[model samples]
Target: MMTEQYVTTSITPLESLNSLSPYEVDQLQDASQGGLFRLFRQCSLAVLNSGSELDSTKLVLDKYAKFDIKISQKHRSVQLELVNAPATAFVNGEIITGIREHLFSVLRDLLYVGTELDRRCSGLTESEATTNMVFHILRHAGAIRPHVKPDLVVCWGGHSINRIEYDYTKKVGYEMGLRGLNICTGCGPGAMKGPMKGATISHAKQRQKEGRYVGISEPGIIAAESPNPIVNELIIMPDIEKRLEAFVRLGHGIVVFPGGAGTAEEILYILGILLHEKNHSLPFPLVLTGPAGSEEYFETVDNFIRSTLGDDAASKYQIIVDDPHEVAEVMREGLEQVTRYRKATSESFHYNWQMHIPESFQQPFEPNHENMASLKLIKDQTDFELAANLRCALSGIVAGNVKEPGIRAIEEFGAFEICGEPAIMASMDKLLGSFVEQRRMKINYKEYQPCYRLKHDAEVVEEV
Candidate 1:
């Protein structure tokens, strides 16, 4: 049985950006193609649809087919009027405070990104430009907390996890919270939501009221994975690349759980950065963990990484199985090391400004059929470049699995063709097959279909 609820409410702005210039307000109110109204509408809908069980972006949009949001400027400030909104976002006919704040946050970030990209600040290069853009977005959302030592741990995993794994995430979160650490994640359900939910109880038990639960997402994914209610601070990046960059840059350390293609993309992104010759000495802690039943999952991930990127790449992170206390203890020690390293290196505590991210990782990856088929997935290239290509391959699989545009593209065309070295393709095929068998692809779909086909041709070898 599914819960069906609906509500309509008009909310006024709160502490941030309540005041907008008449021109700015008018621009937001404009729904024309050239205006910011469409962006605002899509994000607003996602915020209001928080806590939904739906994981398909297209499904969520279709369920609330009649939903609409209108922006109006008042003499004192701005107001949002929602029609046919999801009732789950309300209590007693009033919008949930957190959801309301998130709605406005969507407004705030969309405007800032629009303005910043328009100005093209300082004519920065691709890497510098991406870093600056991430900084600006975090600053706009007030996510950067100065004077606070590196303690924020970013958790990444699938939103459609099993009961035991979900509970294991919470246990890890409880341990982390008991140690007085904060949590950051993609802000959807399952593993993302589990840690925060567990931490809340532990925080209350420890009488710690200032714990932070930050959820970072982007426009393309927000609808599919609606911000869980526990996410007190929400920031929507402009795209997936920026969102992933935000996670690595803002977080002191990262803990990866068992997940599908999306999680693989995240692992590859971080490993690619760590594999860079310049970053070999950086003290960034990466851990892959889960409960006892999840041992096989981590083994598969380890095997895939070792077979493709080699043992040196695998040395960057540690795998701790079925022990939440050890996970938390190691994370605390790792974060303290991160703090000391930052001070020793004279790096900023809030952001990793010293980390070197190559242009290949910073630039956006468009997962079209041709681009997917053209990836250089062989081990002959440098480790960092191989990681980059592998990241793109996983990213394309992610798009095909749940993203609306990717799903639509598959429907219109056909399965995306992924042609690479025979060895690489075979390993990728095995990993993807494992994800499917474990049911990590989609939450509610009856049967999952392959959105991509692996093509191994000898002629492609010469081109590479």
Candidate 2:
């Protein structure tokens, strides 16, 4: 049963900035079309709607039709006024402490990104400026620590996973936590929340008080994948590209669990970066693991990678199966190697300053009908370029699966048409079909209608 209660209140900062300059306050209060008010309202609603059972962004907004938030400048500081907010965020008429922090964290990042960073940082290309902007937003959120070694492991997986897979992720996280490694994830449910929950227990057992469970999300995703309560540090990037970049740059290593199109998109993003010739010698560890049943899933992924990007890209990551202890042991060993490499090269321990991410991957790819149809999924392009195009296709499928706009687009325009080489189209169709059959697409597991159509050449229509 769902609880029903509504409250309207004004909240002041707890640990965040209590005061802002007059100009800054005015900028926040500006509710005009080009102002920050819309961004602030959308993100604020997402925070208030945390722990919601509903995953559809449009559904969430429609349910809370009367919800509204306004920024007010007080004598000494600023306060946020909420109207008809979600009741679950409140306990005994007071908002939860962690949720409140997340709320303000959203405010902080949105404001900094919109006003200060954009105004100050100009004359930079799309990629360089975007990466620099992500760095600034993270640094302002106090997410980066210069003294910390390379121990943060970014875990990517679906929020809508099975109980067995969720438990497996928790077990892996527990093993990682026992070894004193921190966790970073997309900050939603299922696989994202399971690892943090397990790590919390292990952190308690080890008497580690400040075990960081960082959740990085974007505006388009936050409403669907609300920040799980375990997320102590939450940073909302401007878009999906920057958010993905933050994950790779801030963490020392990455661990991928069984997931859906979003997971596939993440995998492609990392592979694209690692495929860059300049990043060849970098000591970044990539591992794909799951329980025994998930072996076939990884095999599909491995085969797809080999078929698409060739053997060199496949060599960038290792696949481990059904061993939580070994996963942690291998991650720890990798981190040690990372530390040695960073020290020897005099690179920063907190961020991967040496890795080169092309503008193709850094820029946001709008998964609209035209953009989806225009993707070049051929083998003739460079390996990195092929990875980028594959990444875009996966991203589009992810959008159609959960994102409200993409869902509506699919409903109106029908399935997105993806044209590519015959072999590549066959490989993609097989992998995506496996994902759907495995129930990895959406949280609502009745039956999934694919949002894409694969075309090989002008004549061949491949099965999806």
Candidate 3:
């Protein structure tokens, strides 16, 4: 299946930003700090590597270290010149059509965020500005369909999963698609690709013309989790926090599949927001589901939440096991309630404007060693606050596992140190240990390394 090691092609826009101004092209040519050249090159490479089986950002870069992309000011238009690109992205000698569209999409989103959105977000408070940036980015990407009803379901799970679990995800997606639900995910392989793949078959049978398979991602992680082929619309949020916000604001319901640290990070992020007293009346339907033999996986997650966040936090989401049809039915019914409530409240059907996401959740969390150690993971804070810290802890682990910079951080320092009270640390230890034991951390690798270690004082002892 391997072709040439590299190929060069000139690419123009398909349905996005047909032309960039001279200033924009100049900025892209600049390699300085504020310039877009490096970001543009990295993202464009990710798009070209969309269909690749590789998931590690480090390996992907090392395999194609010579890969490069440049912006050229063609006559009356702007186009990209890719150099030494991946061979799988080509048919015969030319670039694939879908990859061409995706390449333009990468350019479109990066440019919008770098210039237009950046300029527009200058003078507002941090909270107001974040929401505005999310709205504008999605609007520019044409992700929001004002005329559509509540049908989009955001699927979250691990990129590294067993065949049984992956097949189970597709079955659930097929059932949901037959019921007229669109799909969204973190935009990678495994569970993310499975649902869209399943939904495409049913959508074709049902003749659903506008079945959207939106893939939301950010710059820091796109290299690690390349956008899957099924994503019709791809968005690159400014950071992880905004990416998480986009999921809650854009999706009518959420489907949680079995995953590892990143999946736990997502679960904690959503629970943190939904636990906000201000969001007590929110009608968001959160469902955790999996195939047969996955009972222990869900039990660990359920127990961890119940032990830390208590019954109130556990009540926000239902655990549905083994039955794809029932999962889809429950989600369908929940979305119906969402529709009725939104209609009654006169809220926008396209986005969840009424949902209250706290500023703590809204702010981006840097996963550096200093920031990771500074997280308050104890139970002294509110449930939402503890959830936020737990989310950050898992986020750091995700970074150290697959992200290029985080791997560098670990190689330089050591495994991240996470400490908390005895009870909370025990729960964290159990959850993370299960993830590693289940081999949910990485796929096709020889072994999974411990990117993080739990630190407890003499007064608080626990296994990590």
Candidate 3: clashing residue pairs, number: 0
Q: lDDT tens digits, residues 243-312, model 3? A: 9999999999999999999999999999999999988998999999999999999999999999999999
> Per model, how many backbone clashes are there?
1, 0, 0
Span of ten consecutive residues with least summed lDDT in model 2:
455-464
lDDT by residue (91-122, candidate 2, tens digit) is 88889999999999988888788778976569
Worst 10 residues of 3 by lDDT: 455-464
Q: List the residue pairs that clash in candidate 1.
A: 6-87
Better of 1 and 2 by lDDT: 2
- Encode model 1's per-residue lDDT on 1-464: one tens digit a residue: 32656667789976888877776777777889788887788778889988888888878878888998887767858888899999888877888899988998898898888765646557887679889989889977999988899989999999999999999999999999999989999999999999999899999999999999999999888888999999999999998889999998999999998899999999999999999999999999999999998888998999999999999989999999999999999999999999999999889999998888888888888888878888897878999899999999989988887778888888989888888888888788888889888999888877788888876874332110
Residue-level lDDT for 80 in candidate 3: 80
Query: By TM-score, how accurate is candidate 2?
Result: 0.96
In candidate 3 the C-alpha lDDT for residue 41 amounts to 80
Ranking by TM-score: 3, 2, 1
Ranking 2 against 3 by TM-score, winner: 3
